[model samples]
Target chain A: MKNKKMAPIGVFDSGVGGLTVAREISRQLPYENIVYFGDTARVPYGSKSQNTIIRFSEQIIRFLRTKQVKAIVIACNTASALALDAVKDEFDLPIIGVVIPGARAAVEATTNGKVGVVGTEATVQSGMYTKVIQGMNPKIEVIEKACPLFVPLVEEGFKEHIVTREIIEYYLESMRNTDIDAMILGCTHYPLLRSKIREYMGDKIQIVNPAYETAMDLKRLLEEEEMANDETTEHHSEYSFYVSDAAEKFRKFANTVMPFDVPTTNVVNIEEY
Target chain B: MKNKKMAPIGVFDSGVGGLTVAREISRQLPYENIVYFGDTARVPYGSKSQNTIIRFSEQIIRFLRTKQVKAIVIACNTASALALDAVKDEFDLPIIGVVIPGARAAVEATTNGKVGVVGTEATVQSGMYTKVIQGMNPKIEVIEKACPLFVPLVEEGFKEHIVTREIIEYYLESMRNTDIDAMILGCTHYPLLRSKIREYMGDKIQIVNPAYETAMDLKRLLEEEEMANDETTEHHSEYSFYVSDAAEKFRKFANTVMPFDVPTTNVVNIEEY
Candidate 1:
């Protein structure tokens, strides 16, 4: 009787990094139907050009539109850095990107007024995080580093390995001497590397995951818009996964990050749309 | 007077990995023109879905066609893994991908009868290298590891850190006992991580670079087709770089990789095409 609410919320990433955000969304809003699109075919948009990213984002959005999604989350850092504005302009749906949430969290969490941001080359270069934080408080100093290898390490399921830890420390070593109170895991994949990042940066430095915060924001926004599904029916909400390249790899990764069983992951050719 | 050839040979990757291949081709055949498209906007296609990869590949090829490239080279492993066939069929241009040339080289280099192939998830999952090598000699044993982190490390410009060496050792530890005669750097970016990979594997193992081999193959193919550029005049050769995301990063990376100066690295919106 609630107008048979069935439209799914669409979320996209360059690859499995967005799974962190998707997992959080699923956990926090279990009643809502969700659809995830990972452009695994062209994952790690972090180092690409804005135009190519904008095009890829456009194709992905167009494909998601076909699935009848209510809103879109650009869970990829590189895409968010380079193409979020273009995507939002192209689509009338409520669009959310990790950068904004990350900037907000960094601004709120930094006690020493010195905050560090670490992500992919694209995210750091865009200066979006620095701009957003500075816009909030001009006195805050932001030190940014691009930890590009973290995404590949996480996707390869090497999150806890000593080698992965060593790599994280090496990448984070630069941020060590800086007097920063908080470090935003600007890229979603950075959250998976948090254990090592925490060990390297010490317990004092707060590691902010924009994905978790973005999910929380998503929950609040849905409630405010009266679009939150109220169906308390015992049926488990469905999550349909779509990927651009390899379905098997996506499934394997989903098993690693997802809390519940991913019943169906449909591989769709997004470029055709 | 002979007419000067001006159309660019379009080279594309999900990210900067393709630059290695492009560099080799540019060096060996400078007379031939080049135009590179890095989908840095969306990278790490290794763990993506096949359908989406095909879609992305199609879009890239379609975009390249607009530049009227005489030939198309898919420098991205994930795209080559899933979309090479579709790409070849959809486009009339002579298309070259990294898999076959690397496989051929691995087969030729292996003396112990066992060979190892290291690449991104998509390249390993496609099993194209294994099939190609085995097809050459069924007796050759092939071991494949998806070294996803390597791409990010290379992109982040962390090729020579002790931590990177540690990560490489961690990934290659399994290969120590395998007694592989040759190891193929299947991903173009892997070549940049050569020092680390070589340090772990040792001088005993012959490291094969697909990018170099692919360049040779391109040369051979062009000669066979009688399409090799005949421009022998000084300064007649030209190189143009295009990226989907940021122009500054592309210029910086071009400086690092290119043998000659890249006068201009432009950011072109491939999506609009």
Candidate 2:
């Protein structure tokens, strides 16, 4: 399946939240080269209109095309919700989005047939999770709340704190009253706040993380397509990172999340391409 | 005291929150050029470490230096709280941060000498606003709360809504009990939630927006330096915008925030520079 020695799997997100997905892909397929584009400058795409999200995502896909990626992962919840269909139509490569995998996982995990979805304003507004889940089982009840602060709280590194706890409790107040068996961490960054989320929701509710499930799906897809790299190649696989904004900040964040060498990351300007 | 053409005053923030500052600057200094860089990708810098904030501030300052800016306004509360000192030492140009201007304005507005500050976790944690307010007037009592979700809520375009109102009420519960005469919209983005903030605090508590005060200070500085651009100029005056992530999204936000078309806007991977 390994015909090309140089082609990379391209992954892009509005910002660092997509790193959760990228980290998963790298862990599952260590041999495959990865070229990641983090639109650190114009991230948190969840609040913008559908037309704007599509336009922004198209530019990212166009940028990735230049990198000659085998497939593109729309690793953003907002983009996945609003622009996935259009992106699939526009691009020739296999395009995967977080919403479907997340939706499927949530549906599979739900025992009461009641699912809860939380994300940015844009994601909640799209009703992507509801549509996908309904498509599979129309009987399932879906409850959605836009926890808009989760992204910034994660980005700001508020994984643990009394204030964070207070905020999480306040945000999850709506779901507590609902009869939801499973809750989808609809946004990629939501995983970082999982402990806080879990604490607030208690042990009864199941949590679904699309980033993790999507990684597993990607592994299966590669094998089915005969695109998996052979084990014979002894060369150390490389990851080239590009961020639309501060490279140093990305390096710091990469170190904190992935525990990798900072110097090796190469920052590229996405617009110039 | 005026030159025919002087470089526009450069203003930068983590996201559209800086628009409040930019709009004010444009209003006060109609004749000058304005260049703004919003690190939208890694915004909500309030929770990041001092070192990371300083590093990010340095990169933005370096970028603004290329524009030959007469002065630089660190419109971000997180950056101002954590990195303003290092920024002032590193650059010779006139620099202003929202915290001091905001603190000063709050102190001036408070007839009762009670001031409240609300921002992201890092800004509140650093005690930057409290220290600045105390530095101005030690007798003035300051109450600080980290309204972590405020930025994300505003960014998500949740300016007015029932749920948004509910969340604002929940967050402002502490302030409602406290007797604060005036409150500083510490974060640049906080002003966008003005109605919500105003509704919660009521008219009795004066709200001081640092963005507005910062713009006035910037205008005064330009005039004092004799660098103010005159009305008569041979070349067409225009504003250029840059972001670290998606150009399309930035353009849309810029269009919404600015009444007129931005001459040019693009996403550049800031690390390559």
Candidate 3:
């Protein structure tokens, strides 16, 4: 009901990995202010139950709303797959998730009509990517693998470690042998491990990073809804971050991922919400 | 407080890993009724901040206290390292943690003055094992390495996987060249990966599991305090399990580890506490 064109865009993930998505949004929409929430305390939502993920997503969305966000992006793929539909209908504002954008990208990139998706167990179990990709192109066949160890491996900062490569080999064994020409890095953290993934999956299998597609989707949506920042405003975008637990590690990680200095974010005891 | 001679002994960890300690208690003190709480929802307290771990530990302890537990064991090593000192004086009843017991075992097993301790970053950073082992014998040198990847790998159920072996090699590289005779698996989850560790570390280095020592310590405390379960009652020990997340996977895991059929446990939304 109220004008939200001037309000900040809300982006969130289970932890710091969503910074990849946040970074893309910042790069694409340089003038738009952003409010990012990382649920650092109870992170890696990929393995958690749908009910718990929904509850956490609701609490985070509610928290983001208080920041007067114009629109919200569920940057984490597991949350996007499991929690997005539940919250999108419940909330009033424009809400977009990484899954659909990722699915679209994978659908568009694949020439062999077969695609591989790597995500958490919850995301794979939901079968959302397969369904979404098939919906866009009925002829496309989707192969989904749950790489449960990838998130923890990435979060552990094992980007170039041999263990990571071994893990990549283990997780992508099925995907590697398949005829799928495109693989979706379905979890937000996977982007951070992109090089390792690219190295293992090889050059033939196009890796679809939903963060870039999700940013483009957001850009299009803002333009379609006439909600882009006013040209005359000369907006100097201010980025704010919030998390459920201690901010030290997340802040440090963000400083590496985000272009700007990671600000002193407040720790919200999200359970209270 | 009401006389609790027949009451259950409370035990808790970040997740189902504490079942090792609980299983140990059941084996050693067969007559004791044990109430165990595994914070499955917000697990892997190893990397969490001290304040957050303390708060979660307090909540679990309070939840356990409601069941009229006579003595409580901080089955999680990170919690023992970070939260025990903060909660021990605050609570009225006797509270014991895994660190001292594990340290004692490591010290006793070590033929050489140098002892190795492997655990989560928070646990290693706390320097609890070093301090406790040194407190017993000033001549002993304690080498602590934080294996941040172990808990997640264990939770992912990759006990004998190649990645697990590679990760084990990566984590134990520092300790492998050292003269330390005994390595303490300081975190509860480490015991699950014991076989792989033994293979990697070899038979020359004695491995210490805190679960067994912690149970022994509890047995000693019960007898010393004159609060052992009453012999005249003809007590049948009942084990009750409670976790914060979905119980199916945990229930399956428990059925495998636990001696008795783990009773249908309720999922408690622990944050409310």
Candidates ranked, most accurate by lDDT first? 3, 1, 2
For every model shown, the clashing-pair count is: 25, 5, 0
Error of 2 at B41 (Å): 9.7
Q: Encode model 2's per-residue lDDT on B137-242: one tens digit a residue.
A: 9999999988877766666565664556766776788898989989988887787888788987888989888888888787777678777788645745567788
TM-score of each: 0.82, 0.64, 0.96
Model 2 complex DockQ against the native: 0.18
Residue pairs in collision within model 2: A40-B41, A41-B41, A244-B244, A269-B269, B8-B33
Best by TM-score: 3
Poorest stretch of ten by lDDT in candidate 2 chain A: A264-273
CA deviation > 4 Å runs, candidate 3: A1-3, A231-233, B1-3, B231-234
| Cα lDDT, model 1, residue A190 | 79
The iRMS of model 2 comes to 6.5
The regions of model 2 sitting more than 4 angstroms off are: A231-235, A259-263, B1-150, B153-187, B190-273
Clashing pairs in 3: none
Q: State the lDDT of candidate 3 residue by residue for A128-243, as single tens digits.
A: 99989989999999999998888878778788888888888888887899889999999988888888889888899899999999999999999998897764366588899999
lDDT of each: 0.80, 0.79, 0.89
lDDT of 1 by residue, A82-157 (tens): 8888878878888888888888888889888999999887788889888888999999999999777777677667
Model 2, position A225, has a per-residue lDDT of: 72
In terms of TM-score, how similar is model 3 to the real structure?
0.96
